[model samples]
Target: MKKLGRLEFFWAILIVITLFNTFLGEQFASTALVSVLVSITVMYKGLVVIDYFMELKHANKNLRWLMRLYFIIFPSMIIATVFF
Candidate 1:
């Protein structure tokens, strides 16, 4: 058997999360809890893609942080929109 590389592992995790998100979206009727869970997963998926897929982990500190900030801000925006 072959070992999975870091990118492959992250990819698998993203897939699993995507499937879970789909399930949640289908099963739940857009409740507060479902919204929060979806937001969290989106943030996590954004962070993972930023760090690994975008290869920003070893880049400039400011740039990396800026990318990370998008994930946080957008998810918060989602929660805000859902609530208000």
Candidate 2:
């Protein structure tokens, strides 16, 4: 057995989250709970990609914040659209 590096670990987590998202989408009806769960998962996935996959965890503060802000705002927008 070999050890997984940082990127590999994050990649694996993203894969798992993708699977969970798919299962959630397929196994349930469109309701507020489902929508909120999906949105939260989406935000987590986005942050993982932005911070780990994108190699922005140690980058410029402003640039990192800008990308992170997108993940936050977009997922919030999705939840908002679901309600109103």
Candidate 3:
């Protein structure tokens, strides 16, 4: 079997977190803490995808910053929607 690279490892972690989040969403009522945790997890998953899957790690500084900003802003919007 092929050994997992750092990117693969990160991907695995993302999957595990996603599953855990789903379980949490199903088992517990939607609360502020859950919303915040979900938002943070979404941001983390977005960063991993941007850096590894999108090949943005070595991308131009402006592009990298733009994507990072997008991820942050998008999740913030989601959390805001949940709260307000």
* Per-prediction TM-score to the true structure, in the order listed: 0.89, 0.88, 0.86
- Candidate 1 clashes between residue pairs 3 or more apart in a chain or in different chains: none
Cα lDDT tens digits for candidate 3, 1-84: 243487689889899989989987999999888888899999999998998888898988899899999999988887897758
Q: Residues 1-84, candidate 2, lDDT per residue (tens digit)?
A: 243487788788889988998898999988888888889999999999888778798998898999999999999987997877
Local distance difference test scores for all models: 0.90, 0.87, 0.88
Q: Report the number of the highest-TM-score candidate.
A: 1
Off by over 4 Å in 3: 1-4
| Candidate 2: regions farther than 4 A off | 1-4
Backbone clashes under 3 angstroms, per model: 0, 0, 0
Candidate 3 local distance difference test against the native:
0.88
